[model samples]
Target: MSSYPPSVPPQSSAQQASQPTGLRQRLADLRGPAVPPRPLDARALAALAANPGCGRRALLDGAGVDKTVLAEALGSPAPFGQSQFAIVRGNSFEAKVKSDGGAELLRLVHAHLDPGGEAPGPDARVPDLSAAGPEGRAARTALALREATAAGAWTLLDHPMLALEVAGTPAYLEPDAVVVHPDGRWTVVEIKSFPMIDGAADAAKVGAAARQAAVYVLALERTAGKLPGARAGHTVLLVCPKDFSNLPTASPVDVRRERAVTRRQLERLTRVEELAAALPAGLGFGPERTAEERAAAVAAVEAAYAPECLAACELAFHCREKARAADEVTALGRSVRGELGALTTVEGALAAAAGPGAAEDPTAAALYRAALLRAEALEPVG
Candidate 1:
């Protein structure tokens, strides 16, 4: 049900021969009958950066299958829901920041990123980027960015939608704002409702903001690469409330390290074209179909489940349910998986610790020794 343009660029004979003939058809089929693909946003892509080994997330995301619906059908819904209060507060804060044709936003960027550079005048270009859909808007934004960079003037793109290709699929991202400096460099801006008390915000929240901005930086760089002399700056500007008040405060967060990590993780994702080849025939992962069929189709793919997924992945609850039912050691955590070595199941670990094989493997022997020590300590003093 995605509004994807049907036509792809013509492929050469060698390229045609290299790929499976019906790769796109296979992907379309995977979405089930007439199911629209869920577009991956910057936040979702950032979550992927946190856990690269999650094949289930990669396949589900690449195929554009709605994981929230799938998770509910599996009877283990993801524990994620935004409160009305937070949503209203965030929207209000963002609107206030960009109220004056982004005059306030430009001021923040100038002060934080380039106070020494040219200051943006009242005539700074803030082009209207709204379009029919995400794809159209992204294309419009890219055009505006290129033109702005070429002119080498102070420009601000407010809520500009960007598209980044991940594992052969296009993921759309919309940053709060992006500033094009007079020197033909672009900077990502993140606006948050969290209070920056005493000129400092929570470290965890700041880290999350940096990761999200880094995704935008990556997308911008891809667009800028096509135009000569245009570059996307690695440092991002974060705007937040100051001391529980409505006033805004800005800080430049350097995301070079986060950008490198995200780039590596994105590259490591399994290619969708290759994953499609391995799927079973007539598989349907759509919510419109029967739950049993959807479950079976999803089960066909292997998943690397870990407790950390609970906080990030929408399918975490569903995967956790399956892993717990199977007593998978990875359901505990990644550290537990390493400690168990080849024993991937809880029963297997317990059996090995109690059996003769405990003495063979160092990991098993260590677990057995720790268990005995605990048992001895729990015994009554006699």
Candidate 2:
């Protein structure tokens, strides 16, 4: 996730009411005093959306706590780090695509997304969005978007900062680019280094990129809603490398489904203040705190762990350790946890497969039959 300087904007009456008094201070206390809160980006928000039920992640993230640092302090540091080569390659490719005032990038957008509209010409505008801070940059981006929409000309706002209110707090997001069509429609542009082979890319990487782009689309809608005759397009431009080459390729990814799912999940997330208020008093994850203290503080909240979390969450290793120590069925996987039904522990599942009352439950009966088959197979081999 990207980091930017933190800014606190004035809250409206509705926002103030939604966030209780002293909640921000309390969250600050939960994080170390004098430590800057980590600003969340689209990637973190997408991960949070993927596991909305995990209040631990929601609270930790909303509090602006640095889970990577906290994980290191707890001795279970997250194994999530991008290779330097990948980062350099991504930057180089993005620079190449956006070179010459985004001539190539605009061409791709015109070709793939808006073929019927006017083609981008040399006069296509690339707005400068520089400002004092993230808040200022966000305002600048909004102004540029509004002006671009009204002009009815092809324009690109490169790396524009957009502000999204997540659980009553503002999160600033920066997309690769935003294109304004001649018809006053805005489309998100995501530039990635992954290769699209034979008109296809890795489905997992594509899905991840689409989810991240969906977040940009959602934020764009919030800004476009206030502009007359302006709308954010559900289909976003996904630009990637073409099959083992550095040359950029474009594909249109429709993120309506992803947008809906992310929006619903974000709405379902418990407010950060409320989650903090429910915690016990005097809980802190500061560096001054001992390892045991930090562990206990983290354990105060519940976590829904699955194998998939290993990829998305910084605290997956710690949560997995806890789940395995308790023999929780969720440690196996989400599908296995669901399939086991009422058997919520590995011990319980084993007992159901070998002990009494197996006939009373469908899952248990199936497990019992499978266990008998395994025993027969082993005995015959012996």
lDDT of 2 at 20: 53
Per-residue error for 344 in candidate 1, Å, reads 1.0
1-382 per-residue lDDT for model 1 (tens digits): 0011212122212222333557655655777646656667777898887787777688788777778888888777887856767877888888888887888899999998899999988889999897766667778999999899888889999888887888877777778889999998899988888889999999988998998888999999899989898999999998999998999998889999999999999999888776766778877787667889888987888888888788778888888889999999998999989878888899988876675566688777877887788888999999
What tens-digit string does per-residue lDDT give for candidate 2 at 219-270? 9999999999899999999998899999999999999999999999999888
What lDDT does the true structure give each of the candidates?
0.81, 0.86
The top-ranked prediction according to lDDT is 2
Q: Candidate 2: where are CA atoms >4 Å away?
A: 1-21, 358-366, 369-382
Instruction: Give lDDT for model 2.
Output: 0.86
In model 2, what is the error at residue 338, expressed in angstroms? 1.6
Question: Could you tell me how far off, in angstroms, the CA of residue 72 lies in candidate 2 after the best superposition?
Answer: 0.9
